[model samples]
Target: MHEQNPALGLVHVLRAVTVEFDLLGAEFAARHGLHPTDVRALIHLLDATRAGTRATPGWLGEQLRLHSAGTTALIDRLERLGLVRRSRDTADRRRVLLEVEEKATELGWAFFGPVIGEVLAAAEGFEAAELETVRRFLTSVLESVGRARSA
Candidate 1:
């Protein structure tokens, strides 16, 4: 199929990539003895840490589309695994914050480093303009998926 053929080429590429990611996620979860949802919650917490932000059970529940009870249970499981810790916010004693443990953070980086390196290396083959276009395309795809989910 021609690269310019959105229906045949782009759509197939998108679908394939999505499936590949899903499979990869499942594998990662299995390796860590976690459920897929737990892996996702960990990823969200990791992302928040990288962004210099803290995640709360309430916020994580909303993000994961899980109820409060479910979120609390997930958090409890993670804590038992030594992957995460819950603490009271110093600024707000009533607020509880979830933080990824250092060992768990290291484990994630070690497991995902090769894949991340390969992705970066692949992007290095593209010119700045091409990379920018790819970024924009991915952003649009993400927005579209979010809209579809909400609908």
Candidate 2:
């Protein structure tokens, strides 16, 4: 309880959430015949697209902490699966960019749409101010994790 150690309780909850996500990710990987690293790469590409950021293989390599050969191999695997494609940047024809294919998005939504819906349904229980507080808390937690990763 908060009376004893609030931080420990929050950490436990976060850990539980992480475990659940990892399990779900594993299931998705198995069903799709993808390695965990492949799933992570897809997620990074999707996030970058959503953020309106151009995602290059080099950037993805950094995000995945992979060497060029590993990154190329991963990309090749995804491309062979038709889940990803390489495109030349129009602004700089020499630069290659990674793009998630529609099939990948459709597959991802097919698997995770219900989970997303449930999350939104649960969020509906909170008032605006309460949701704001939750957002702030989550943002701080993300920042802490980012700092720890860099350190």
Candidate 3:
């Protein structure tokens, strides 16, 4: 249903997409016996890795809005599950950095691989210029949401 205000329609569509992803995350969390925050932390860790940034406890705490004790506890749990490991930064022997384990990647791929493939197939139908416009729009939305979160 197209609305007179295209922006409002876009907002509704985005919200629907967000809800579906949230539900998928919830399912994954339940299946793996993990907390919602754990899934969120893993996602952030993955994103940091993709961005070529070292993920430290302090940085993760800031990203997750968690305090030291909470972050430590989360790390400990993930560590026990074999999903993450803490390694001392080679360049800075005293600093610790978080890393996602192979097990975590395997588990994530097993669960999300099909969905990612479906998304890719859908994206393949879009022309390059149309996809670029969609990418720019989503990037702007992400930036705006980040600003709102910190405000």
Candidate maximizing lDDT: 3
Which has the better TM-score: candidate 1, or candidate 3?
A: 3
Q: What is the TM-score of each candidate against the true structure?
A: 0.91, 0.96, 0.97
lDDT of 3 at 68: 99
Model 3 misplacement above 4 A: 1-3
Question: How close to the true structure is residue 39 of candidate 3, measured as C-alpha lDDT?
Answer: 97
Cα lDDT tens digits for candidate 1, 24-129: 8898889989999998998999889889877999999988999989999999999999999999999999999999998788877887888889999999999999
The C-alpha stretches of model 1 lying farther than 4 A from their native spots are 1-4
Q: What is the lDDT of candidate 2?
A: 0.96
Which of 1 and 3 is the better model by lDDT? Answer: 3
Clashes of 3: 0
Candidate 3 on 1-151: residue-level lDDT in tens? 5447889889889999999999999999999999999999999999999999999999999999999999999999999999999999999999999999999999999999999999999999999999999999999999999999999
Q: Judging by TM-score, tell me the better candidate of 2 and 3.
A: 3
Clash counts for all predictions? 0, 0, 0
User: What tens-digit string does per-residue lDDT give for candidate 2 at 56-115?
Assistant: 999999999999999999999999999999999999999999999999999999999999
